[model samples]
Target chain A: MSAAAAKAKRAVRRPVSIASFAQSENVRRDDQHNEVEMLMPVVAEVFANIGITKNDIDFICSGSSDYLIGGPFSFVTALDAVGVWPPMPESHTEMDGAWALYEAWVLLQEGEIDAALVYSFGRSSPGNLNEILALQLDPYYLAPLWPDPVSVAALQARALIDAGKGSEEDFAAIASRSRKDALSNPKAQVAHDIPVETLLRDEYVVSPLRRHTLPPITDGAAAMVLAAGDKAREWSDKPVWITGFDHRIETHSLGGRDLTSSPSTAKAADVAGVADGPIDVAELHAPFAHQEIILKEALGLDDGVTINPSGGALAANPIMSAGLIRIGEAAARIASGQAARAVAHATSGPCLQQNLVCVLEGE
Target chain B: MSGQTTAEDLGPVTTLATPIRLDFEFTPGVAQSRFLRGLEKGRFVGQRCPTCGKVYVPSRGSCPTDGVPTTEDVDLANVGTVTTYCVVNVPFAGQSIEIPYICAQVLLDGADISFMGLIQQIPTDEIRMGLRVEAVWVEPEELTPSLASVRYFRPSGEPDADYETYKDYL
Candidate 1:
């Protein structure tokens, strides 16, 4: 062993693949129902599809933010959908639902549990997400300016523009492409095939980023079931196995890192083996139109790969659930035997500071 | 008339939630135990990795690079340099300062690691990268086992330095 190896303990590693996944329609805004009511159907559907109950779940994990709910420990009330009267083993991460999947994957790596249920929910329409995200900034210094999410994203857009990497027209092209592809997706909320020139005529929410480039404010939820080894075989005729998974976080301060490039996404792509082979479909959770381009380059996807046939975050960004929805969409493709392999990505924090990437496959 | 500030008018009104300070005495792990204990003793200590010979200020017992517990304790000065910083235009929950203040990354002398702190004894508008700074240690009798023991960083009367000095620091 090398000198450092003598000091470091041997780390345990194993493989845990996804078995099932489900999500609700990407709504523009679920005004009639609250978050709990909106999330229940999605969870119930997953349980019914798998022939399982709350008690059958060995572990339960979820992801969300208190800021979105405008209350502390907002996730506490979410347990109602979970029916925690018996108090099943549970934990929560204040991140995207994909990270919750990562935590469940870790638990499964312990080699004790056979199945886990992961979920996430958010209602962005209740409060302005752009203004709410201002809280993530440094307390004493930058946060008081109330630098909303769109403005931060706009700043990054301008930086990319100044760097000569791309332009506003390019952003419009991404939106037009997404909406055209989403036209076939029954669950897509804001799917349309408006000409790129028509989209360019739209007014800017923050300069360089038009309303079309941003995701629709939405309220939704999602759930995914994970099983490994023999348990995976019992789930379906075609089980989409999680072959690789990894994520990375950059500095919280936007000024500290290069806004034009996503090193975190690039690093996570490398760790998750996104470039290993032919990825039939790649679902990216880029909330902004230009971000899709940055993430595409960062992930190193070629023209042959499919990008978000399911409208993606731009169509209906439900705060916390939007990223997780990408995973669900990617897995749905493989579970239905449409694609043999797929890649899904999720992002959180301002300007996509943290990202999670997972590769799904069918045997 | 619907005279009340009810749910419909506000479009999903929330119960007012304010900045809450969630204070927990997170006991420093074995790797950070001595380093914290030293702070309680009012002594600035650093840990030296026997192999890499790099020292960490706000000393950690484990060399982050070596991943091994550090054996030797190296005492350090209370002085450091203001690496890079931003003007705080907003206030946040659990913050002890008012608006228009400066939060800087301080690279302590003889230490490879950097830590965050409030910059005082200088105008927020005048704060710049690479500003020399020194810690204003709290009264020995009033010191607690928390990072708040060091009041803030104050100007050390050094000339303004270039960005390259701390450009890569961020």
Candidate 2:
């Protein structure tokens, strides 16, 4: 390749830093407040952490799902929490808040906006989440059958076992370690330090996967502030720079792809430069215990990397906000001088069909 | 391309209908809980946003403009001005109201936001913007923690409100 063309392809974009992060206490049911009330404190805390106000933000973006709330235009009402008076530029995504963060990152890369606010909220307790999640499947072929999320994850677990890649004991170990780590996380909804042997003794919710392997249904919200270049330096003393970020998705048809492996995650890891340096900490948004094993393999993390230091989605999976919380958890560690470099991962769709990987560093 | 067949050559089209039924129970939040309880007491309770000073009926919990919780409770009069309205002539399944009824956006006195209310005890053609109306409550014995406590609204026999009074609500 010509030097000019190669240089053009290798061009690096402006860096965006995660200046601040905050999240609501993950719980089974927050009966006292609605979506707006749930997000108000989180949004306020995120801005307060950075010593900034809504007027300082150039753009606002949020992530949420209307299906979880049983209403259309749900995010429109959520905008009330951001105090959008004076008419600010804003956008929203129906997917996870991590994708909303990605949108804000892309806008910052344009070098126009100095700072942006990203937030997301979900309340999964008011409805039958298993039945609601089934709606995300193919309406004609899969949804009509009403296969709940646990059963789908069970199928993936069974596939992994059949492929001789892992066992049920491995799944229990992941659960044990995650919940134990969650003991320090005051925001986590489920936290316990039960032994793997005790977890294995429990009855299976579905064949080859026990109740310990599944994630808890949670109601929560999270917010983060992203500032570019000098603005980042002004906000945070230890800014967690987003050095590389990318996301990829595989085919929607579950039967068409290998359930035992995650190709999309591996591809995203490559694009996000996961192996560029030693990873001190990693927060993987794997809702199920076994999926963490699959993601570890996809991201090529070795035994030295500390995984799910905040207990991860298995401890508090709040649907739309869980993925964003993973990004926040990883950045918080780096910002606190606990880690120099980290990797945060988020997944969407059934069986980890879609994935996003972000590499963060404190410089 | 020669293997392609026309629609007429195909025998028939097949389609499947799957009916999905989901049940959910929602708990009214802090602001809504108070609003509903006030309705049970035959009172019209509204909350005012501290930042914008806009009063909202039935308390939206938060102000859409300022994104702050409406803190101060404002007790509004039963009478209101019709900012805009629609005559529902067509019927649908499970509709409680009869045909050709006037459903209007009622801007309550001392409140900035408008709420949907049923206009009754007057001809549909007479229900226009700036028409003053008052709530017609069900008997005290039938009162409940719901908007249904007010059967409907009727002409208050007072002078019509000037259009300028509620034009902003429209």
Per prediction, fnat is 0.00, 0.58
TM-score of each: 0.66, 0.95
Superposed by TM-score, candidate 1 places the C-alpha of residue A49 at a distance from the truth, in angstroms, of: 1.5
In the range B12-114, model 2's lDDT, one tens digit per residue, is 7688787887766675778888888888988799999998898888776888787777878889999999999999999999998889999999888998988
Judged by DockQ cut-offs, the docking class of candidate 2 is medium
Q: Which portions of model 1 miss their true places by more than 4 Å?
A: A1-13, B1-170
Candidate 1 per-residue lDDT over residues A164-263, each given as its tens digit: 9889999999999988888888777788889999999999888999988988877778898888767777776677778778889999788898988999
What is the interface RMSD, in angstroms, for predicted model 1? 19.8
With a 3 Å backbone cut-off (N, CA, C), the pairs that clash in candidate 1 are: A141-B88, A141-B89, A144-B90
The lDDT per prediction is 0.78, 0.90
Q: In angstroms, give how far residue A163 of model 2 lies from its true place.
A: 1.3
Given candidate 1, what's the lDDT at residue A303?
89
